[model samples]
Every structure is written in C-alpha cells, then in structure tokens.
Target chain A: MLDNMSLSRHISGQFNAELESIRTHVLAMGGLVEQQLTDALKAMHKQDVDLARRVIKDDHKVNAMEVAIDEACTRIIAKRQPTASDLRLVIAIIKTITDLERIGDVAESIAKVALENFTNKQYNLLVSLEALGQHAARMLHEVLDAFARMDVKAAIRVYQEDDRIDREYEAIIRQLMTYMMEDPRSIPNVLQVMWSARSIERVGDRCQNICEYIIYFVKGKDIRHTSPQEMEIFMDNNR
Target chain B: MLDNMSLSRHISGQFNAELESIRTHVLAMGGLVEQQLTDALKAMHKQDVDLARRVIKDDHKVNAMEVAIDEACTRIIAKRQPTASDLRLVIAIIKTITDLERIGDVAESIAKVALENFTNKQYNLLVSLEALGQHAARMLHEVLDAFARMDVKAAIRVYQEDDRIDREYEAIIRQLMTYMMEDPRSIPNVLQVMWSARSIERVGDRCQNICEYIIYFVKGKDIRHTSPQEMEIFMDNNR
Candidate 1:
C-alpha cells in the first residue's frame, strides 16, 4: 500500500510537470502573437508592406502553436485526469488558449487590411490607429502577465481597461465617418482603417476574455459580461 | 458482484441524467436569448416601449439561466469526473453558455438603444431595420437548432448564412451615413438605428462562435479562426 501511494504521488508530480510545459509553450505562443500585432500596426503606420508580409507569414507559426498546444492539452487530460483545482486550471488554459489563438487571427486580419491599403494613398488618420494598437498591445501583455501569475486583481484591472479600447474604437469610427463625409476619395482607405480598428478592438476584447480566464483560475468564477463594478464587489467578497 | 455492478450502473445512469439536464437547460437558455433579440428589434420597429421593457426584463432571466447552467456544469464536472467524450461535452457546454449569455447582453444593449430613441423623433427607416432584425433572429434560431440537435451539417449552413447579416449591416451603415449627410435632422435617430444595427451584427458574430462550439463538440477539433472551406473539408474527412 505504501509503495502504491508513492507511485501515485510520482504520477501526480509528472502531470504537474506536463501542465507547466504546456503553459510554457502557450506563453511563447502569446509572445509571438503580440509581436505580430505590434509589427502589423507599425507596418500600417509606416506603410511598410514588408512588415505586413512578415505578420501574414507568422500566422502559420501561430496556427502551428495552436495545434501543438491543443494536442498537449488533450494528452494531459486523457492521461492525468487531473482533479479539483488541477482540473479547473487545465480547463481554463484550454479555453484561454483558444481565445489567444483567435487573437492571433485578428492580428492576421489587421495585417491583411494593412497589406490591402499599402498601395492606396496613406491616411493621416493612421496616427490615431497607432494609439489604439499600442493600447491593445499593452493590455494584451498585462493580461498575459495576470494569467501567468494568476493575479485576480491584475485581471480585474485589465477588464476595467476594456472600456478604454471601446472608447478608442468609437472615436476612430466617428473620425472615419467624418473623413468619409468630408471626402469621398478617402472612403475606401478609411474603411480599411475602420476594419483595422475593429480588429484591434477585438484583440482587446479577447484580452479581456483571457483576463476572465485568469479570474476563473484564481477565483473559480466566471465574471464575463458583468460590469466592472460588480466584478470588484464580487471579487472583494470572494477574496 | 451483483451489488457492485448495480452500484456502478446507477452512478453511470446519474451521469447520463446530468448530461441530459445540462443539454436541456442550455437549449432553453438559447431560446430565451434568441427571443429577446427578436422582440427587442421588433420593439424598436414599432416604437413599443412595453416590448422593449419586456426584453430588458427577460435579460435578467437569461442571466439567471446562465448561472443555473454554469452551476450545474460545475456540479456535474466535480461529482462525476467525466472522461473522454463526456468531459469534452461538459467543457463545450460551459463555453457555449458564456457565448449565449453574451448574445443576451448584446440584445439588452440594442433594447437600451431602442428605449433611448423612443422619446425622440421617429424615423421611418424602421422598415429596413425590421428586415435586418428578422434576418438575424432567423439566423439565431437556426443556429440554436443546429446546436441542440448536434447537426454538424446544419451548423455549417448557419455558418454560411452569417455573411448575409454582415452584408446587411454594412449596407445599413452606408444608408444611415448617406441619410445623415443629406439631412442633419435625421442624424440622432439614424445614429441610434445604426448602433442597433451594429449590435445585431455582433449578435451574428456570436452565433458563429456558437457554431464553432458546435463543431468542437461534435468533431473534437478547433475550427475557430480557421477557414470555413477548410473546416468543411475537415468535417468531410473526419466524418
């Protein structure tokens, strides 16, 4: 009986090691995705088709990472059958990785928009978009940090910042409308920028989704779509 | 040996019952959310504050349903320790409920916009708006059916129809912009209508997310952010 208990403990330790390995791969994937978004936005601002092409090419890496991480998760779940907190952590990571992978897709969408507008007349409006992209990238980094650390407080802060991206998105839309109304010649170009802004806003939303996963991992509750105020109150009571 | 076998069968039976209950609750929640979107759009068309209020009130019920379903999932996952396909089904249902709840929130946002514009001047643009709403409502209904029935082929059809809502949303935005440009008096009401249209477009996007979840549940592959054509090929090959 003693030997059997010792062997089970050893297996549980191996499962934790496997889970950590998967987490490491996911974080590396997140880093590549963040770079893709950043470079894509910068490419748009500078009208550098080369950087845009790089982003488009890097999506394959993201896709490959997604497949590997997914396979790792499946094997872990099937082999380890982790329970309780371990189970929740694995589940949260699986769902959160999917969201992260989708964020990479949006980044690819932004790169496509940038590439499409490369030959068009450059919009002076791309400057404001740089701001939106920067904010989104910063949020993504913070949310990933929150996820890695399992910091519910940090995740809560990132969730609060989603409204900032929404405000930026609305501002961009109104500005694009103003430009389109002022000059029909700029309509197509502005429309491309609108799609790009929408993509960035989507990235921010997915970052918030990641933060929600962090809350779930740490607190074991889903606080998505609820108001930030309510989240704070609930987090306070729960903690 | 007979008693042990009977106890094991009884536990397995309980697991199946819990799975059925989860499926039933999710479908019921999906129906409630779909109805909220339809009624909110209808209320906007008819300028019926009463209907709008009902949609708003029903959002609370959707929230309650989401909580009930999530708790059920938590209890089932904890008590049953489901493995293999059963584990996947539970995780997929948990994620799908989150998507459904977000759809409910989007409907509430539309209803709130409807209420805001009720006291203001009326716009006759509600006819096209009503058509757009009906299209979206139908799409939601079909997708929900595909989900409940686990009909992957039917779910793929819903995925194909999502573009229709996207095109309608773009057209409405352009029409509203043209109206605002031609007549400043139409700006406020038309803008609210545009906001509602955008919300409806997001609802369509959420439906696509649900379809992706359906594919995940049925096929055990993540097709999200992948090309639809490729997904169709995958479904063919795997099936």
Candidate 2:
C-alpha cells in the first residue's frame, strides 16, 4: 500500500520534474557531442585511427541519449497536457534534440574523415581544421549554456559565431581546391579533408539551430527565418 | 459577435479538425518540397541558371509554410489539450515539418549547385543526378501518401527505396571521383556537383525519417533507431 502510494506521488511530481530531467539529458548529450568533436579533432591532428574508431562507436551513445530525451518529452506531454511555457519547453526540447543529434552525426562524419587521413600523407591544413573545430565546439558549448539559462543575449552571441566558422570554412575549401589543383596525387585525401571541413561547417549550423530553439523557448517566437538584423534587435529587446 | 462566435466554434472543433488541417498543411508543404526538388533537378538538366535562381528564391515559400504549420500545431495543442492519438498526431506533425523544412534546405542547396555548374563546363552527371532526385522525390511523394492513408505497408516499401538511392549516390560519387582524377581542371565544378549529390543522398535520409514518423503514428512506437530487420519484423507482425 505504501509503495503504491509513493509510485502515484512520483507520477504526480513528474509534471514539474520532467522538464528539469530533460534539460539534464540535453546537457549530458551536449557534453558528449562537444567531447566527441574534441576527440575527433585530436584524432585528426594526431592521425590516431584508434581514437577515430572510438568516436565512431561512441556515436551510438549520443543516439541513445536523443531517444531517452524524446521519450521523456513525449511522456510529459501525454500525461500532463502541459500548456503555455511547459508546452513550449517540451516542443523546444524536441527541436533541440534533433539539432543535438545532427551535431553527433557531424562529429561521427568528422571521425570517419579522421580515419581516412591515416592512410596517406595529406596537406597541412589540420591547423585550420582544428581552429574551425574549436570555434564550433565553443559555439555549441556557449549555446547550450545559454539554453540552460534561457539567456537570449548569450544565444544571440552564439549565432554570430557561425559567421566566423563560415569564413574559416571557405578559406579551407579554397586551400583544398588549390592543393587539389596542384597535386593530382592528393585528390582522394584532399577530398576527405574537404568533407571533414564541410562537416565542421555543418556543426556551426547545428549550433545556430540550437540557439534558435533557445530564442524560441524564451521568447515564444520562431526566429529561424528572421533576418540577422531583426534577430539581433529581437534578442536585444528580449534581453 | 458572429465573428467571435464562429472563431470560438472553430477552436472548439479543432480536436478532430486540427489533425486534418495540419495534414492538409503537411501535404501542401510536401507538394511544394516535391516541386522544389523537381525544379532544382530540372534546372540542373537544362543548366537554366534563371530557373535555378527562381528555385532558390521560391524556397522562402516552403519556409513560410513550415512556420504557418508550426504555429497551427502549437495553437492546437495549447487550446485543445488534445489527448491520446490527437496529441501523438500533433507531435508527429511537428517532427514531420522539421524533415520537410530540411528537404527545402536540400533543394535550395541543389539550386545553388545548379547555379555553380553554369560558371564553367563540368562532367555530365546530371542524368544520373536527375534520376536520383526523381527517386527521392518519388520516395517522398509515396511516403506522404502512406502517411495520409496511415498505410504501414506502403511506408515500409518507401523505406526500402532508400537503399536504392544510397547505391545510386555511391555510384555517382565514384563517377565524379573518376572524372576528377582524369581532369584536374574540373576540380571546382566537380566539387559543386559532389555537394549536390551529397544533398540528394541526404534527401533519401529525410524520406526514411518521414516513414519512421508514419510508423510512429500508426503503431504508437518510435522505430527511428530500430534495425531494419527488426523494423520489418515488427511491421509485418503489426500488419
């Protein structure tokens, strides 16, 4: 009789507890993604094929985290029939998980590229790629922090970081193109590096996506397609 | 008073009609996505830069549709507090629209590649690319069809088509690599084509995502991470 009573009380508390629990999962997953990117970048820098393989294998954990979070969000919505901010939070978590999952995918792709760079000597663009990875990982970390705090201004700052990553991505692409043009022998390896660079660029996009959700969660607005200037203004006003 | 009365009535009827209305929006958005991919593919074939540019610009319409549908879903959930299948349907629609928006992004990316190809002559892989796009677009069309009817069998068949698209994508990538090796001068153009091919391959992924949602809606289960063999068995038994 006591166990049944406690179980029912636990279910009752779930309405308030679920959001905080989901946020915990999101942060845990964010930490894993950030670590995955860091490890992948290190693997690429050192050409450690073993570390690269581990990153690839560890992606399953990230996938599992997403499912756990999604199921949590779904369960909360079903039982609570949550409205207003609770509803928005559940919806935003769903969106945030998708972005987080995509970041894991990108990290996995980068790890594969890291594996490829082991086979042959490639250009010395690892420095640039490492810089790009750091920028993206920091952006992701900052965005997740902003999300936790529901800080619109902090999320807006993360959005601007995408531009820096984009510029770096373009520069790396140009360098890859030049290298490919000059050395036909390096085409395959260069192609792999191009893909890795592209994946890093996509990480920037995932960061932007997370920041957008943070804005949505706080402001009750979808600013994904908004102009940059407008987004900035809205963020400032909300802050 | 009449307007207010009718609006309240509409909100009250939203429990059943909301799902149907969201379905209409989804199909409308799917139709536009299908059209965008078709036009983007067509632009690649004709090398019609003008048509490609138009496709790029037209992507905003798809984005707008996403926001509109999203708002509708949010409004329904908040006002109706729908339970059971109605809640699941609303949540699934939210997921589906994300995939649809991604399709729009991919289509826009393809259009940009189509624009790039016109800068200088490149390898002639458009025929294969067009075939891949058609397969993806068809898969998308069929999945949306299955979704509308809640036909698990049809959705399974659409899921299987992803294997065909992946194979075609690999074959095209090989062809592009061969072309790149033979002619270093074509590096830039070939890279753009490669990006476009990669985007098409991702479309196949988005199709599978939609099919997963269909199964979720029908079976009240999330099979997104399920192994194909298990998914098949579950679907067969469920059927």
Off by over 4 Å in 2: A1-14, A117-120, A236-239, B1-13, B117-123, B235-239
User: A1-239, model 1: which lDDT tens digit per residue?
Assistant: 22223223434566767877887888898888888888888887887788888999889888888778876876676677676666667767877877787888888887777666433344577777999999999999998887766777787788779899999899888877776667655555666677678878988889988887777766667675476688668868644
Backbone clash count, each prediction separately: 0, 0
Docking class of 2: medium
Query: What overall lDDT goes with each candidate model?
Result: 0.76, 0.81
List where candidate 1 sits over 4 angstroms from the true fold. A1-12, A118-122, A167-188, A225-229, A234-239, B1-12, B118-122, B170-174, B177-192, B225-229, B232-239
* Model 1: pairs clashing at backbone N, Cα or C within 3 Å: none
* Complex DockQ per candidate: 0.22, 0.53
| Ten-residue region with minimum lDDT total, candidate 2 chain A | A1-10
For B1-239, candidate 2 gives per-residue lDDT tens digits of 22223224434453667667788889999999989988888888888799899999999899899999998988888888776566777788899989999999998888887776343346366665888888888888898887767677787888888999999999999888888888888888888888889899998999899888877766678887766697778868754
Best of the candidates, lDDT: 2
Q: lDDT of candidate 1?
A: 0.76
Residue-level lDDT of model 2, residues A128-226, one tens digit each, is 588888888888889888876777778888888899999999999998899888988778778888888898899899889888887777677899787
What DockQ score does model 1 reach against the true complex? 0.22
